[model samples]
Target: AQSVTQLDSQVPVFEEAPVELRCNYSSSVSVYLFWYVQYPNQGLQLLLKYLSGSTLVKGINGFEAEFNKSQTSFHLRKPSVHISDTAEYFCAVSAAGNKLTFGGGTRVLVKP
Candidate 1:
């Protein structure tokens, strides 16, 4: 299957703590990576991506990940998080369709 998989659908953490949501994908010929975050009642915003080069890629809001070609995985990580970080995060892939094939989704709850 040409789809990305998010292992954790939800992660709860207190404010100023660290968190990580697992993500994996089926190997592909060519792949473009992306992570979008939907905060509260907001739409999805691009967090980061690994289009090419450099296994490690950084994105907005203190987030980053490494594109592991061998493992076919790209997991998001944040050293320290804030309450405002609470939101629904989606890992997506686009191999052919203009539309993105999103993972189930993961909700990051950063409580005070």
Candidate 2:
């Protein structure tokens, strides 16, 4: 079994400033990590994922995440955030052929 935890419940950042959303997981088996974003009144969108290969994974909208096996962490970062980046972010983990376990969402508010 696996569980995900998002460290922050809310993050506020100025527009064009760098931002990072922390995520951690616990599991006894290999798992896939994912980061999703949900804009206001919109469905979730895939930000990035760490399935296999390199530890550093890049995703849409200039977002990237580094998968750390030793720490069991996959943290998402954006060098510069825009007003459009304001949204709710979720961290998820799944074992092979199992359902995904999601962490409590983190809401990001971008200030001008």
Candidate 3:
């Protein structure tokens, strides 16, 4: 079984500033991790994922995440944020052939 937790419930950042969204997971078996973003009044969009090789994974919109086995974490980061980046982010984990487990979600508020 696998479970995901988002360390922060909300993150406030200024435009052009860097932002990091912390995510941790617990699992006994091999797992796949994913980050998703949900814009206001919109469905979730895939931001990044870590399924196999390479500790660093890059996603759309200039976002990236590094998967750490020792820490059991997959934290997302963006060098610079924009007002359009304001949204809810979710961390998810899934063991092979198992259903995905999602975190509560963290809301990112970008200030102008």
Query: Each prediction's TM-score against the native?
Result: 0.92, 0.97, 0.97
Candidate 2 weakest ten by summed lDDT: 93-102
Question: Model 1, which residues run further than 4 Å from truth?
Answer: 96-99
The residue-by-residue lDDT of candidate 2 on 1-112, one tens digit each, is 7899999999999999999999999999999999999999999888888899999999999999999999999999999999999999999999884898999989999999
Residues 27-105, candidate 3, lDDT per residue (tens digit)? 9999999999999999989998899999999999999999999999999999999999999999999988489889999
RMSD of 2: 0.7
* Lowest-sum lDDT 10-residue window in model 3: 93-102
RMSD of each: 1.5, 0.7, 0.7
TM-score of 3: 0.97
Cα lDDT of model 1 by residue, 1-112, tens digit: 4788999878999888888888888744578888999988788899998888999899988999888878888899999999889899999987653557789999999899
Model 3 misplaced regions, further than 4 Å: none
Query: Using alpha carbons, what is the TM-score of model 2?
Result: 0.97
Candidates' C-alpha lDDT: 0.86, 0.95, 0.95
Q: Model 2: runs farther than 4 Å from truth?
A: none
